[model samples]
Target: MSVDVPRRIVIFRHAKADWSQESDHERPLAERGRRDAPAAGRWLASAGIAPELTLCSSAVRTRETWKLAVHELPQRPRTVYEDRMYEASLGELIALVNETAEDVNELLLVGHNPGMHALADALAGDAEGDALARMNRAGFPTAAIAVLTFQGTWKSVEHGVGRLTAYWSPQE
Candidate 1:
């Protein structure tokens, strides 16, 4: 099979939601989350990590978080809303990534966790000791970004096949 290696896949969980809201999926980002989203975006921009495509969950919080982050991106990428990403499982998330258009070299997925956290752990290979330990200590926080590299095409991305390039959390 021809390998269509994706240089990087950045997964971001929506920022913290207002718990006082009734509907979990509809909850908007909390005040703290709003502030942190831009900070995280700045970090990505400063690092020269820009995505070619953005796949975001349809949930309000996730959408809002994506909006905040995209502002800091050096260039705006094409975006698509995927409802399945709202509460997807690790396997489902992988499938979504694999389904991305082949021409897109870098992809960003903005969704929720523990699916995001689980996917990170499942795909990461040879992660830095400090990063692995930190990921294990705390499930990915809202507004956290996990950068993973895959050797083969996005269509062939499988569990345990990616290297953790970097991880960024708001608290860090």
Candidate 2:
């Protein structure tokens, strides 16, 4: 990959889950989440942010969200469901990104919060405008998406090197 090429990482928080289930991993998406996931996917597709690869958490809610969302994409990306991503730490997520193949430029990660939120905050050094400001005001919520762009290969992707191009939530 050329140094001039920019890699984009799209981080997505899984949609609202059905809390009636006892197992965290087993919990499925709520009724609202089922409807919202496709909207987020369409938004990304319409914005020309189609990913070349998707890393999804093994949790039921995350898996279901990915299932519903990809239908709205312009193209189907290679996807993997991993158990580690269910509640991965920022470092773990960074490591995963670093390990991405050089050819893959746009990567979408569907996982849970706290780690995803921290990862976005750590990687994004600068913001365009109200995207970062709004995130600071409301915080990352269900079905929210954060887009980070940086001029480098996946191997070079690092903390505080990304530019937060956009942030969106289903509530909006």
Q: Give TM per candidate.
A: 0.94, 0.96
How many residue pairs clash in model 1?
Answer: 1
Q: lDDT tens string, model 1, 130-155?
A: 77677767789989888888877787
Q: After superposing candidate 1, which stretches have Cα over 4 Å from the reference?
A: 1-6
For model 1, what is the error of residue 147's alpha carbon versus the real structure, in angstroms, after optimal superposition? 0.5
What TM-score quantifies how close candidate 2 is to the native fold? 0.96
TM-score of model 1 (CA atoms)? 0.94
Listed per model in order, the count of residue pairs whose N, CA or C atoms clash below 3 Å is 1, 0
Question: Which prediction has the highest TM-score against the true structure?
Answer: 2
Candidate 2 lDDT over 62-115, as tens digits, reads: 999999999999799999998889789999999988989988889999999998
Cα RMSD for predicted model 2: 1.0
Candidate 1 local lDDT, residue 104:
82
Q: What are the RMSD figures for all models against the true structure?
A: 1.5, 1.0
